[model samples]
Target chain A: MARVVGSRLGVGLALSVVAVVIVALLSSSTRLAVALGLGVAVLGVGATLVSLPAVRRDHPVVTRALISVVVVDLAVVLTFRVSATSNSNVAIGAAMAIVLLGLSFLTGSSGQISLGNGAFMGVGAFTVGIWADHHATTPLVVVLVLATVAGALVGLVLGLPATRLRGPYLAGMTLAFAVAFGAILNVFSSWTGGDSGLQLPSAVVAPHWLASYFGPGASTLTTSSAWLADISIVVTGVALFLMANLFASRTGRAMRLVRDNDVAAELVGVSLPRARVVAFTVSAAYAALGGALWTLVNNAVSPSTYGFVLSITILSLVVIGGIGTIPGAIIGGIIYAFSAGAISWLTAHLGLNPQGNVASQLDGIIFGGLLVLTIVFAPMGIAGLVRHGWRRWRRG
Target chain B: MDSFLTSRNVSDLLGGVTSGVIYALVALSLVLIWRSTRMLNFAQGAMAVFATYIGFAILAPSTNYWVSMAVAILAGLVLGGVTERVLVRPLYGKPEINPIVAMVGLLLVLESIAAAIWSTSSRALATPFSIVDWQLNHKPVALSPFALYEIITSLVVMAIVAGLFQYTKLGLQLRAAALAPEVSRLLGVRVGRMLTVGWMLSTAVGAVTAVLVASNFFTGLTPSGMDGVFAFGFIAAAIGGLDSPVGAMVSGLALGVVFQFVGDYVNSNAIILVALAMLIVSLMVRPNGIFTRSAQRRV
Candidate 1:
């Protein structure tokens, strides 16, 4: 147990450092055509070096931790490079990755299902949008903090009733929340800008200070995007680290016990309602942070953006990544980003019209098929597959 | 007070009853599935819409509504059986959430396929009955010829379903299997096959509800045509008791009447909110539903 905890801490620190470095490298270079090639080589070497000690120690936990950190590092760099070169909306991908990570923590700790985190995310985005509209001078950090608080408040209200409901009843209630949230947004169109959404003001940045650290050629928009990505990575790393510690603590064990058997948990003196409420509130706060980051990155907020589809997509990410595991959520996010790109690429390459039925339905086909296949075949998800393969490789 | 009970209000009440019959049909289908499988079919609405689309295809070529309806019901049975055998059987007795998640995936896939094949555009389905309203004392009443057909057809189907459950041998087997699969299997009943039949019959009921609603009330048949109906049906089932068919029927009609009055007097956007509010209150007051026996415990 000590060794496991030590390895987790080491992995968390390594991930944070790598995230900061990637942000600096990506934000500094305008000639990403050259940076892309260099970044890949640097990442490959770094991965090799990180794995060498684990290989020598032959400690399973250490080896697993090292492998996960390396994979996350590789994904970040590759995704950044792809977005830089192709001009795709990598910010959305990054935001989604962060949200998925947060969701994994929430669902992992407590065995309850929430189909309304998207609504919480909307609350976060709208908080930022509305705040930015009125208070242009406030720093972005403050805005995010306020948004998170608002999200947590709403989550508390939702979570209160959630404690009493179980299974489909809980799911149905949350679904209603998502639907009603959309309607509320429509009804209060004047404040929320109705269906048209709200536009974010131009991001305030100190170019001279950034240039001194990141070299001289970085544009403001690129810098802003990179900065948001960096914050997302750092926040995700911190959240994962905290979650890892929490899972190893007494509270985490009790929550898991509650999830596995509520009656048993209650018999053991654990407060089921309190534990559930805390899990939900924290999860909602995490989703809100992701939403605030999304608003910063996208510079726009619309009610339509946080609908049922988004909620389902987030749920799919958690399930496909591997429920109750951080590594699984990261893997799920990576797959989600790549699969989305692949669908678009296939449509474009096949010369399918974007507005046509086939093109429009491709995403649902691929993701839905993948979801079903994952659950039916890999009940434990990508992380489970990896673990099984690792065991086999070791035996051989 | 006089204005509150005007002709418009009376018409709205009548319209609510007509629509309530459709809601009750959907609620009955949901209740049937839940009672047998202990799984809430999230894909119920999507499956119904798919069947309706299939019915539409047959109708387009033959212009025979009866044949289309019959074929659709048959297709629903096949779809339900295959889904149970292939997708649901593997996850039986696992965590309850597993099936729910799988059902959501199925919903997405089915809806996407329908959209791909039929496009997202809404098309008018042909109905045998006239849409024109009847006259009462020279003032046009809410009940049209199609509305009457809808009410009568739904009543007949409900009666048949109630009879099947109350008086038939197969129904007894189905109940035994649902209540205790292991015990039923020991008693020489094919529990697995009974569960599949339950799915088929329930899905066929859903198909009937979809066909009836689409032909007269909804008019515009699209991939997501039954989403609203599904939500209403879920609320109705919850109000009645997830385990009680009689409760589903009564709650569905009550919900329809309440929604109609709310829509007429209050804001239309508040309908879902009201339903959700009612659900919360009901669950708080009686977690097992108003109709359920107090001795029963829900997890």
Candidate 2:
């Protein structure tokens, strides 16, 4: 029997839509938050029951339904949590995960290496910063949409040329893009705030009713961060779901075919440049979304924050975490969020002063070392390695 | 238009000549690694920076320029060799992306190590010669003694590398090994060792260029100090010919002068944008190189 990937997608799309509607209608309520949490818990218990080997074989649809329910439920629940620190971290992780997913999708699935992922993120970040500063009344959803569109346009402009270019030439252009981003920020200093960069007019706040419902007397700062975290999670969940669909779609197969052999892809009626450009454009859009979310989370945008170093960092994260897998992208996000403190802690224990250069440098040292080691010894990355081990274990 | 070429402009052009050689040196270094390994060394800048840190460690206490220079070069030689042997060797015949990935990884590691050792703060290189501008006929010129040192040192290294490639038995073996490893092996070339040596010499020269470039600034030794140099050098290599040593030098020098004029006439900060534009146009018009003859390209 043909594995109907479309059925899974259809189920996923419907569940996500229903989830979005429920949130939209309720918009804000402690009751809704409690309901979402309890609902997910019940769904989880039922999923576990249905996931028994015999039941899993008989009704795989339940697994698909459970996954969508769990994903959407957790995304909602995360926003209602009151931990500002954790929310800030989650926001960072979500933004990074979004960027990594796009990079992993582009580089892993279609074999296009872009050193300018950070620049695209910058474009989105600055977009929101400028937009929020200029058009302070614009809704968050609208602003994010505009940012995504801006990214798509830039990606289209670059991706059109990328279709003509091959390996070294492509790398060179992307490299130039990353390097020149600072110049761009400088040249448009009037809008960009030049060296200092720009800040959003205010922290992204939850709707008044929602804020009041969740926090009658809570600090606005923590509530705003939680709101931003929820936005980030929801956006990431949507992006992840879309990517999952893309991976299973005919277009995904065409991309794989092109990556493996463009000639074969052409023989099979896939337009090579079109496929490449689609991947590039979509990836850029995803990166833009990540950047916009980050701007909201940080409430500030700077040229230095999204320079070549960040680009390289994003690439290393994706590579070390496992390039092709969703879980790997998540792992990359977790590492990016926590690796600094972990490395600094380790360095301090080794007698390096916490305030010194070695501690600051260890982050890059470990990131670089892991990137190299992964490429040389475990090219499939951590997630891939785990999957390989699991497969072997099952076979044994 | 009249304002474009004043006495100051003449001095600017003169200044370009001295500074151009630094870029030329960078290009020359890149060409060596490319020719030897048939792979672009993404870590070239990081390696150069690390070598300079090695030099700085000695120079800070001893205040001896030449001795530190020698130490830096030797350090580069060993660093390059170990990197090629341990990190890059296993990548042979693998996917092209693997080498790029590996080299980038090496780049990060080297840069991070330098940062850890020296911190990211810029340190003085302590040159013997004065960096003050030389004046001629009551007008300031760009050719300071240190600038002259920068020029002479870079050009000389470029000359030696170009000469070695053109007229030596060692160069021949290195070229043969890179171009036809199996055939060279049959010819008793010790192909792997040649690669290791090629990387060593290449990075040693890179170390020299890096020292020269860094000394141009009073406070230039930092982990990421070589980044801008590397970017332009890569641009220079691209325009010269990824494969040709002499081509890299000529184009690099020319690019430096061109960059200077642009910075002088246009926004200095926007020069990188100009570099990107030129790179795109050049890649479009003459992907093989503006200067070198056409050759088979892997990419």
Question: What local lDDT does model 1 show for residue B22?
Answer: 83
lDDT string, candidate 1, B86-184, tens digits: 999998888877887888788778888899888988878778889888876667887799998988998998998999978999989988998898899
For model 2, residues A1-396, the per-residue Cα lDDT tens digits are 224433443444454455544544453455674565446444454544434454345545544344545664665565554457767877788788999988888876677778789999999999999999988889888998999889888888777766755555466567668877888789889999998999777777776766555446544324677667777877877777778768666898899887888777889899988888898898898889899999999989988998888888988999999986777887898787677557766886899887887777777788888898999899879999999999999999
Model 2 spans > 4 angstroms off? A1-69, A75-82, A208-222, A344-352, B1-6, B292-299
Task: Give DockQ for candidates 1 onward, in order.
Answer: 0.52, 0.58
How does candidate 2 fare on TM-score? Answer: 0.89
lDDT of 2 by residue, B168-227 (tens): 998898889878989999999999999998889878988987888777855478888777
Candidate 1, lDDT over the whole model? 0.76
Q: Is the docking of candidate 2 incorrect, acceptable, medium or high quality?
A: medium
On TM-score, the leading prediction is 2
lDDT of 1 by residue, A175-241 (tens): 6676567777876777799888899877745444555675566542345555455555545555555
